[model samples]
Target chain A: MIRLLEHEGKALLGRRGFAIPEGALFPGLPPTGPWVVKAQVPVGGRGKAGGIRFAATTDEVRAAADAVARLVIGGHDVRAVYVERRVPPGREVYLAAHVDRDLGCPVMLACPAGGVDIEAVPHERIARVAVDPLAGLGDEDAAMLARALSPDGPPPPALRRAVADLYRTLVEEDAELVEINPLIVGADGTVTAADARLILDEDAAFRHPGRRAIPEGTAFEEEARRRGVIGIELDGDIAAMMNGAGMTMATLDQLVAMGGSVRGLVELHGAMARGPDHLAGVVALMASLRPRVLLFNIYFQFRNLDTVAEGIARAIHAAGPGGLPPVVVRIRGVREAEARRILEPLDCWVTDDFARACARAIELSGRPVLRR
Target chain B: MAILVDARSRILIQGITGETGRAYAARMVAAGTPLVGGTSPGKAGQAVEGVPVFATIAEAVAATGADCVLSSVRPAAALAAMTEVFEAGIRVAVLYTENVPVHDAMRMRALARARGACLLGPNSAGVISPGRANLADLNDARVRAGRIGVVSKSGTLTYEVIDGLHAEGLGESTVVCLGGDPVVGTGFAEILRLFEADPGTDAVVLVGEPGGAMEHEAAAVVRTMRKPVVAYVTGQRAPPAKRMGHAGAVSGAGAEATTAAAKLAALRSAGCTGVDIVTDVGAAMVAALAARRGAHAS
Candidate 1:
């Protein structure tokens, strides 16, 4: 999921014909008097973290932007501030559209009580409708959401249209989530999105050529992304490499349970499909973490183990003697004998038993194996 | 008879001209898995390694009477390919594409449910009923046909469990890779229900990971099953909020319901034995089977 900044999200919504407060990314201010300066970060709880400020004058707006730009909320550095013309806060409501995993459908959720935490909102206040992916958000469904937002009377056409357009943006943009917290209903009966949080589906990036640049996460993550391997860093001495995500986690759990801590783990997610050289590059990247022991717990179904073996051999040859860490390999499935034959020349302990291999990795990491 | 695919299942490969599709076709044919025909749009009349190719699934089905489909279309075209498969009355489909848009997945799942068809995955490694069929990614020679049924969210984890079971002198009746997606077409509960009714299946080994309520749903079905269930929920030590390779394998904020610990507890409470270590899964399955046998003997 690529989380879009407030301005980017608003711009997307605005393109799809949704009403949004006029805003500009600071160091430039919007041509207006009253403004809300918000730190443009991907995470939530920015308001509570003092990342949001209200200004009534040009000097105050400049000061607010400066304050917000310097603020770091939720460990993310605020690179920019979103300055928007402040609408005199009226009835605050919450509206969002996202793919609900449980419902197995695109769902539209709306609540009359919005500005506050949606999690804390009373169950009765929240109105949700599962939009059929085939038919999309129907007229009845939009009206139902509108009624839920305004219980005393029928909702204005603007609210209904906004709700429908929000769903449109969510579907058309291939977004995972599009949320508007405090969807403000002004005193003059105008509905506008005060804040936007859009998460585009990374899987659907092929359809979106102009998708915003992905923010660099951790240094290890950036390197992993560049290398096309999944590398997750942990605070331990053992480095583990596995074929799939679930297996990687399972190996980590088993290693940790046996008194071994993991320095990092690299998941061979289709990396081996590119052949031995690509796999070697991934291994070289994993070695950069400087782990005490490198553990390979690979269980390939369709993928040949010989490819992985050749990759490990290439990585070892590239690193030279004593440059690489002590390695323990537990490989099975698809050309196991051939893979073992390829790795025999390397200074590595190869086995088919997962437990023994894990124990060896822990011992090499200088940790005593825990007896149950 | 095997649960999903058997000797009777006439298989068709969608996107049969693609690299992955060609690989699956060759393996399935070599394994003698009743590979009847295939379909690749604009590649009609082209025979891929002795298998007849058609332009669409309907044409393939009409020609070969294909009951099951192995869909290897790209992520962008996966949904359309699945629509073709389901619409052509294909009862079972193994979607081999990964990274399908979540909305597309939802719709595909809905279509499958509406048609009462079994759609395996949009990211799935597919399923295999050892010796009987070779629709999955597993090399048929390595998988010995036997009585214990296997269902898992992860493809590689299934290999680990299979190896562990082999060490305990156990083999599988069928192995289903549910795919590691947040919203998959098939879930643990559905597969558990199939294993429960399968005469060849005496026990089940469920390989689960941290994240998703599929395990919770599986527990609900396990509570009613007479067959013994042994479970290994991985990612016990995974850091919270980190996507551990699989898109669905994430420990989200404050949602303990999807955590590995919680999933293990649910399975245990449902009268299933849970293993803390991955290698111990075989031992746990052996114990559960022993207990079931003891109950039967009495």
Candidate 2:
């Protein structure tokens, strides 16, 4: 699921008739008296990264926006700056609605302390209430949760009912996360969802039309996704490919365990339907990652390895002279020898030991391979 | 003895006129799995693989005495399809459709439970009693009928595990794919209970990915089972927080939703015989079976 930035999240809240601070994303901060220039990013801990800054003057707002927008968090480029009207300090109240998972239903969680990280909140203070998908949130429970958040005024009865309805909004829409941090209760008894954060589960996207666009992928991730494979860019120097999500992760862990850096990861999914051409695409993609070594730890049951091997051979030939990553393949099940026959001709090292393949990957990376 | 299905089981194919339905129907009939007939809304009097087709499941069951059904309808129509099968009084059913709404799954699950009918998957690959019944996505040529019982959420991984077992001279009595979706109609624990009671099932090999408490819950059942269980949890080395594939694989922090290590550890603590990789599944199965035998001798 792609995380919606705070600005977009707050706008969604606004559409749902919730109170939120006026926000705008701007290429440059306009000449304004005061504004909060926050970096629009998907990663957490942005406040600690100095991505969130309060600007007292137009020049400061412009400077902060320009500076923070250039910063990268979790490898994602911060393209635009989220500028908003800063709210006055008040008591922090936290509220979130998410699927409890274990209960197999949506749950609403609320606590009086909100501005700080929810994880850091004391367990006893956090109150959880399961919302029935069919019956929805009852009025009494909503009031209790809202009262638990603010004992003094305890959110007006109507507001508590609204909060309950918001939970319904999250569940029926298949939202993975709906968080309101520091639900500001002004001295006038006005309740506002001050900080909004929502993450909609992508698997349930068919239910919410036009909620998301077909996401753009990085050069590596795009190639892999197109082949119905999972791909991720990493900092390591070894480019690794494997069959199945489970094996891809194991290979990555093994590489990290062996003191090797993984540059990229490609997982071949539904490999039987995917012919040798998909394998060829994988080889070319790994070559583009420009790793010192390419590792394939494929374990197949019904799928044939001959097609995969043939694809790699074609990719190697297509790579031109010295165009391939020094390969280390560990293939098992369904035509092992035929796969080996295809790869052995390319001069790629072939083995079945996961650790050995990793060690070879490190060695070929021209780095001192550290023993696990 | 095997679990859920065997050679004697009579099966019916719902939506047999559809491409996937027709394909599996032909394979099942060809493999000689007592596929009596098929049901399509408007395809009555037609034939799929020379098996008579009826417009409704009741008519098909009345004519052929079919006990099992493989539902291959689309996601939007899966619940209705299963409901129709249940109404027809089918004892067991397998739903091969994915993307079923959560509410639909809940209704189907509740209806199946109330009716004393066993539902395999909303997104499941139909169960196979190799050499006897071929009602699944797995190719019969790749499998052998034997004493092992295999249950998994992944179709390809199930094929991999069964292939490994076959390589070790073991054959499965029934291989059930519980489905890879988060809110599938049935779960690992429920299937384990059925396997435990099945006379044909000598042992069970459970293939699980990191997600849900299904494996952990199943582990609790395995702790008390007389039959040996070898549990394999995939995604042990999954990228810490990045969801790879499968909706069920997503997890929350410190919550054991979908961490392979956490799942494996939980399974072990609950007295399950655990293996980390597919390659080691056969060896683990052997080890578990040996322990069971030793316990019996003692």
Candidate 3:
């Protein structure tokens, strides 16, 4: 999930007719008398990052922009600065919409005290509503959220309409997160999404290319992608290969709990669909993991084990005994006999035992599998 | 007593002409899993692994009385496969395909629900009632039918757990991998409900990873269950969710989706025994069973 800066986020909101402060991302400060120079980064806490500075004079604006642009925090590059006319202080409120992984729908969360960290808001103080994709967020729900934020009365028709439209834009754009922190409802009672931060899911990038063109993944992700293996390097050393993501992660967690270091993780969900060449790629990749012992713990519910076995066998043949790492194979599910037959030739200890498989992996690595 | 499939269940294989469907058909037949028939749109007049082939689910069901289906269609063709099975009135289906479009998953899920069919997965590893019948991506030779009901989000993890149980001189009543997707058809809670009702299932072992609320939802159900459930949550120290193979593995913005610590806490708070290491899963199940026995005796 990549975070869009406040300026970009607000610009999108403004384009969608949401009340937003006009902002511009400039390499250098505009020749102006008054402006706020804020460091442009994806993460929050920029104000505390010593990156937010106000400049009343044109010369001051240039210097502030220059300073803010050069500041880097938390490894995020700061090459640009946001210049905008500062709005007068008013009651700070917050609104955010995101996909609730558990409920399996979009959820809108709001709180009246928003300028502060949203995380700091009391759980009960936060009001939440689920938005069904099939049925769009209706008027009553938007008005309810507005009322929750403004308990005294309903938000004006314009603000209510804006809120509803913003929610619609969020769904239409296929966004994972569209947050407006300190959605200032000014003393004059005008509501504006003062800070707009959006995070769009990369998986849905194909449908919404306009705002969803995800930047190339990080270096680690790119490297993993090239291998056709799901490589998630963690703080441990016992690299593992499994058929599914949940299994891969569970193995890593188990190894970590057992006090073994896990250097990498690979989930071959569709590798069974591929042939020996795919397995060869996996073996070569595992060799790169530099694991003291590679764990081939595969459980197929409907996939053929022979495919995994063949892949491992071919990879071992390609790597040769000297190049291959000490390997332990714990396989189950359909085509087991055939898969084990293939792995047996590669000196892989084929077992249908979970503990034994893990023990072998740990033993070969000369490590203890910790328990938690 | 089983929730979805049992010893009496007859199974049908959809997409039986495909390489994957054929492979599973051979294994299921070899395992003596009450193999009935298969369905492939244009391969109706043939036989796969001695199982009669029909062009449609209705014909296959009529010919073999097969009430359960293992769908092995491609992602793009998943909906059509499901529609065929659903229309045939199959009571249970395990969709073994992944990367299906989200819009398709929703529509298929709704269709399955409307038909009162229990759809295991859009990316599921299928379900196995141990020695009774096997209709999943799992290795038939490795699983032994017994008392423990193993439910997981990963097929490999389910195998690992089943292997652990085998080493302990135990086997599964049924092992179900709900699939590793955010928008999967079946969930932990629904599977737990099945385990709670399965007379053959003495206990349950739940394996989950970071990046979904399914585990947490299951934890809530476990709090009210009569059976014992042991859970293992992965990605404890997993550096935040990294996008790679599975679409469901992506971390949603929540404490429940991306953090193992949070999931583990929820399980524990819900009164379910939570273990961190996969290797300890067997021991946890044993302890849960023992604890249940002690409580029963007292």
Instruction: Please report the candidate that would top lDDT against the real structure.
Output: 1
**Over the stretch B218-285, how does candidate 2's per-residue lDDT look in tens digits?**
77787888788887777665656556556566554566545778877877777778776565678788
A221-290 in candidate 3: lDDT tens per residue?
4565666666666545566787767677776666666667776777775555668787778767766867
Q: Write the per-residue lDDT of candidate 1 for residues A1-372, one digit (tens) a residue.
A: 788888888988888887888788886777875898999888889999999999999899888888888888988999788888887778888999998776678989999988888988888779999888888899988999988887777788889888988898898898879999989886667898888899888888788897654854578867887777888989899988988887889889989998999999998776777899988888888889899999998877667899999999999999999989998998887799999999988899999878889899999999899943
Per-prediction backbone clash count: 0, 6, 29
**Tens-digit lDDT string for candidate 2 (A72-171):** 8766778578887777666668888876544555678989887888888889989899765545678878888988887776477545855776786686
Candidate 1 residue-wise lDDT, B59-111, digit = tens = 99998899999988889998888898899999999987889988889889989
Candidate rank order under TM-score: 1, 2, 3
Candidates' TM-scores? 0.97, 0.84, 0.81
Residue-wise C-alpha lDDT for candidate 3, range B1-298, written one tens digit per residue: 5557877898988888898888888888888888788888888899888878998999988878889999878877887788888889999899988766554565566667778888877778889887788887776677787888888877766766776777788888888888766667778898899889878889888877777777778888989999988888766756664653456665544444456778888888888788767777777888888999999999
Off by over 4 Å in 2: A27-34, A88-91, A132-144, A150-155, A213-218, A234-264, A270-279, A291-310, A326-372, B8-10, B39-42, B54-67, B75-93, B98-123, B250-258
Candidate order by decreasing lDDT = 1, 2, 3
Score residue A344 of candidate 1 by CA lDDT.
88
Off by over 4 Å in 1: none
DockQ of 2: 0.25
Considering the two chains of model 2, state its CAPRI-style docking category.
acceptable
DockQ of each: 0.78, 0.25, 0.40
